[model samples]
Target: MDLSFDCIVAGSGHAGSCAALSAIDAGCKRVLVIEKGPPEWVGGNGYFTAGAHRTVHGGLQDLLPIVRNATAEVASTTDMDPYSAEEFTADIMRLGNNQSDPTIVRAVVDGSRDAIGWLAERVHIPFIFSFHRQAYLVNGRHKFWGGMVLSVEDGGKGLIAAHQQALEKAGVTVWYDTPAVELKLDHGHISGVVVIRNGERLQLSAPAVVLACGGFESSVDLRAKYLGSDWERAKVRGTPYNTGDGLSLAHSIGGQLAGDFAHCHSTCWDANAPADRGDRVLSNQFTKSGYPLGLMLNTQGRRFVDEGQDFRNYTYAKFGREILRQPGGYAFQVWDARASGWLRMEEYGDDVVDKVSAASVTELAEKLQAKGLEDADAFIETVAAYNRTVTAFDEEHPSVKWDPAVKDGLSTQSTRESLKLPKSNWALPLDKPPFLAVKVACGITFTFGGLAIDPDTAAVISEKTGQAIPGLFCAGELVGGVFYGNYPGGSGLTAGAVFGRKAGRGAARVMRS
Candidate 1:
């Protein structure tokens, strides 16, 4: 097979696939995708995702086309509020504590809707409302309030397969089990790449190269070195292949690292999940994020963080670090029957394990004890105190109002007298029958830090020279300066698609020149 190409995309995740598609769409005939893993793991971390894609849109009208199965009755009742570019930009910047690059954030925000539309219309990828993650039923109507309203038809793996099929149909070649080892520089510009395939090292020359591989989340050495001392203990949430090859290659050629290297997109994952990538059958089901509706207790049966401080999208990323800091690098999410109903169905599939349930809180505590928890009395007392001190409510002001976005329910009104951390909202008395608990541990999704890139062209920028390398481009988790302490849910895929398209076009333009 010919190794030479006009453009080479490292990795075959959402970003790399989009980059390859855009390059071919831009008339670059020779486009090849070099994937480090085999075909089963071709999607990288993107394959494990729920396929949520955040984008700016003008309410339900703008959403109708992409949500292909919307019935007339559903369309009439479902409410999808307008999410503007300004709102998207503000949310990203504010969540990053103003640490994100304004220009890159602006570009991503402005192009998100177009990116989604392009994938749906041009690439023939189907989209639908994200019923599991973003929608809520209220007063006989379903309201989708978060900017994350749409996702590809069959979640992340399906989405990746769909795009890969589309690219293959267009005659783009994807080399599996081939990893790019080094960037070959020609006169200070990236001219080619050195790759390892089947025990042989081959140098593939391309006029332009796009690095959409991933970050260092899967590398224990890199995680401990950059993310903190104990970060090596965090569970890996996706594919083990994202060991920061692109970032290291870029750094060797003077690319500046951007964002806080110590921060990552972490979450509350199942304690019994595999140390590396989770099971493909369960996919993202290893996550247990319904903490807002219940209590997260440390080993000693004490609430550590306020469960209802914000929406799950705003708080889930950073909470895994806290969970890791607890004793034994784990915790338990306890909920009653009411909250159990609200638990995502994905988390309770046939493949799930490590859940404990009982008819009473005391019995639940005993069941938890058998699962290695120490004290049942302490847990009983904690629930008793929580229920006793919960804020009073009457028929007029109910405990929960079913708001789709933000904290919209009863909270422990003044834990002012208690030393324990309080539940800020959606704090119902855990007195219902059939109490349940799930063991949880820290799962590191992706590292937030990576190589900085030029906003306009997605070109890799040199920290030393403050100039973009002529033929290098990047997207996906390899591009930094977009996130810091936290990330809004569904934005990662959107950012990937947006910048991937830009990087593809930029590389194609370079190759054409």
Candidate 2:
């Protein structure tokens, strides 16, 4: 069977959704989005995110002015100190170990802010301003899954329900549960896609195709092959459907892949442990009480890293690899009453005390049965040693500072000012009593590496010559080399918007030409 449209977008995650919407906005009369799985409530990882976004124009100077100017209305001041383009680029280069494509990185940074603004105007996505000065910060207040949610919002069905009221009103055709199985290429140009609908396969012809399928985080075999042995053992916290369909599709068509070697964010605790599957208790407790404070110790009971650093930094992957050397890649986080008090407030809140009880250090250790350490005495001793070291350092150093700005430092300033323990008190010690310990397992949200694309328009590029694959484009995690190593707070969503728009607009241009 065969069908034809102006454009066909594969996958229904944030990137695909944005590509469809942007295509429609760019004046494409016929656009069809293909999603493989059933529509789900959570809507993939976008719903689980803390929702931060950024942009620092470095190499894409020609387009920087357009994006910067377009994003002016939604740009918010941040308390988090900003890194200059050079600093940002340097940080990315260092993180990527110089493996990333400089042109792709520049395009992402240059188009970021404007993409946020575009999504807000098009979908009524709400954003909050950050108090930090150095960084670009914004709040995503769209209902459940809007804004970034629009990209993969159940494969654009949700967007079709709300904002796409305008699209339908404007005559956009959407096909549900249609999975793109093959790319229809003719004479080195993408002509369409072969899709399976209701188990019936059909060819959907189009002038251009956008492969917006998500990354390969869900495929354990692929994770082992591309990510390494460590990712093979890592727990996944996001969608199980993102199995690199886009990457596979692009590769089959001779599209180049980039950033296939980097990862962002690390899990200190696997809240998805089988024993705790249905219980939000673990997450609730940790987020409120802050049980994972102070120095984190592996099974052998020794400090491995500075516990205060943001977990999002891929550096945690190094710690994860180290901990996996233990019995099960598991570790214990020890803290006292004061730390517990803060953890309760920060992680679980006061109400969790009623659910899980441990009045003393020994009792807490007994409850958790922490590996390596025998009982609460061992846990208490570790806490004492940590406190002693903290005190000695405090007296000797007098002042503590982070080289680059810390995100969310300002919103948390009131808590810091009240503690009066120094700026590094953000790096607080576990000095108090009746301590707590919880076993943490490392988990990954999604893989960062994917297909390489043209930095100028996000069109999929050939691996041989680094030239664009005509009639093909990509965005979000499916297109790599954009996010160096560490993902700027909200780049995932922002990237989808920015590159999705560019890919859509560029595809429209190809069709018109």
In order, the Cα lDDT scores of the candidates are 0.85, 0.57
Candidate 2, 114-218: lDDT as tens digits: 675665567544443322211222243111110111122221233224334544554656566676788878889889888888888788888889887777767
Candidates' TM-scores? 0.96, 0.76
Model 2 reaches what TM-score against the true structure? 0.76
Clashes of 1: 0
**Tens digit per residue, CA lDDT, model 1, 196-286:** 9999999999989999999999999999899887888899999999999998898898988887787999999999899977677777888
The top-ranked prediction according to TM-score is 1
lDDT of 1: 0.85
What local lDDT does model 2 show for residue 118?
67
